[model samples]
Target: MIINTTHHNTEHKQIIADLIGSPFSLLQKFKMKGVGSKRMIIDKVSPNMQSMMNKVSDINYANIELRPKGILVMINQGLKNFTWIIPYYQLTIYKVNGSSLHAQGRFVHFKNNKTFKENKKFFDKLLDEKVRYDMLFAMPQGI
Candidate 1:
């Protein structure tokens, strides 16, 4: 999702992309039947993400959106310690598999990349909605 090239921060963008790319995303998909939505304070991170976060500032969570009592993520528009807000007008989001987004950075690979590949429908549903991507926050670097 290359939106604004004017300000670029590769590591920061990778962190946000990694979050979306990580199996953590599926944690929301198979949410317990009636569990309520709450803020996400992700302290323990995957090895891949931890390695990536090390290159940036101290990680934390923030609710940039005005959604009350909803889950929040720690990211900014390619900056340290900011909430990520996807710019729908300029960027297109995709779900790709593997440890991170595809090298080309268009499609998101989700096959065999989730905590539970047992459910193929979840996988298909993710890809099927490419046209209606969730407003994933796109963080441009060099802020």
Candidate 2:
């Protein structure tokens, strides 16, 4: 689900929380080592998500924040902010030419630039979280 979070909206907050679980407590965040990624330059986005990017700007930037059961991909457009909520089961990430995050038929590609290199550890942490979440539903070996 994508929401315009430039302003504080109670309904939006509730929806996001229900979709991906709530934000982690300070202690949880501390144990996770960190739950956010450094800013990254966006290289491209799925055609359906073109509107979320600023066409006028040559470069777009985004960052990711880890949630208990999912992750939030936050895109900035001038003064406006858009967030894409992706649960662990629905999220797909790839690192071909650069980093690509896809969910709900939309995707955003982050350039493999300096900023992306700086976020290597964060990406690893995200994958680990996803694996942990998925294990909760693992089937029995003989089932």
Candidate 3:
């Protein structure tokens, strides 16, 4: 899944539309299971999935031609036989010339029925000094 801090807008929507037009691609659907909030689910209907996809679609569409800038904090793991159980997180900041103005969020390598909170502490710590410092320090001055 793709994640970005930018608000979902028209430009981003176009990018998603293009990706959806491609073959052998699937879009994730967000559904509300309870009163808490909505969560993403894999959708089998191709066109419908593409049409409904948001967030990531918006991010990619908006910055389709932009080169990656700033620092990207990525957490990845390789699970041998059980590849699906691996958990990964990536946060990317897209810069405009000299300053960061866009960001994307991602989570992958999750197994079926897996829960994020199971690794919340680890994820939180990464978001804290470890990941935060890395991103901030890696950026060029004025970015």
Which candidate comes out best when scored by lDDT? 2
- Taking all chains together, each candidate's TM-score versus the true structure is 0.24, 0.96, 0.21
Candidate 2, residues 71-124, lDDT tens digits: the string is 999999888899999999999999987899989999899998899999999999
**Ordered list by TM-score, greatest first:** 2, 1, 3
Q: Deviation in angstroms for 102 in model 3?
A: 14
Residue-level error in angstroms, candidate 3, position 47: 18
Local error of candidate 1 at 128, Å?
A: 8.8
lDDT of 1 by residue, 1-143 (tens): 22332356787555544443322334554552222222222333334334323355653322222111121133322354433323323223233332122222222222232232333443244333333444344456695
Supply every candidate's count of residue pairs whose N, Cα or C atoms clash at under 3 angstroms: 15, 0, 4
Reference-based lDDT, residue 71, model 2 = 96
Give Cα-based local distance difference scores for all models.
0.33, 0.93, 0.26
Candidate whose TM-score is highest: 2
Model 1, position 56, has a per-residue lDDT of 53
Candidate achieving higher TM-score, 2 or 3:
2
Q: Native-vs-model 1 lDDT?
A: 0.33
In the predicted model 2, the residue pairs found to clash are none
Evaluation by TM-score, superior candidate among 1 and 2: 2
lDDT per residue for candidate 3 within 1-143, as digits (tens), equals: 23232344665444443432211112211121111111212222124223323434231111111111112212111211110111112333222222121222222222222333333333333334235445655747783
Model 2 poorest 10 in a row by lDDT = 52-61
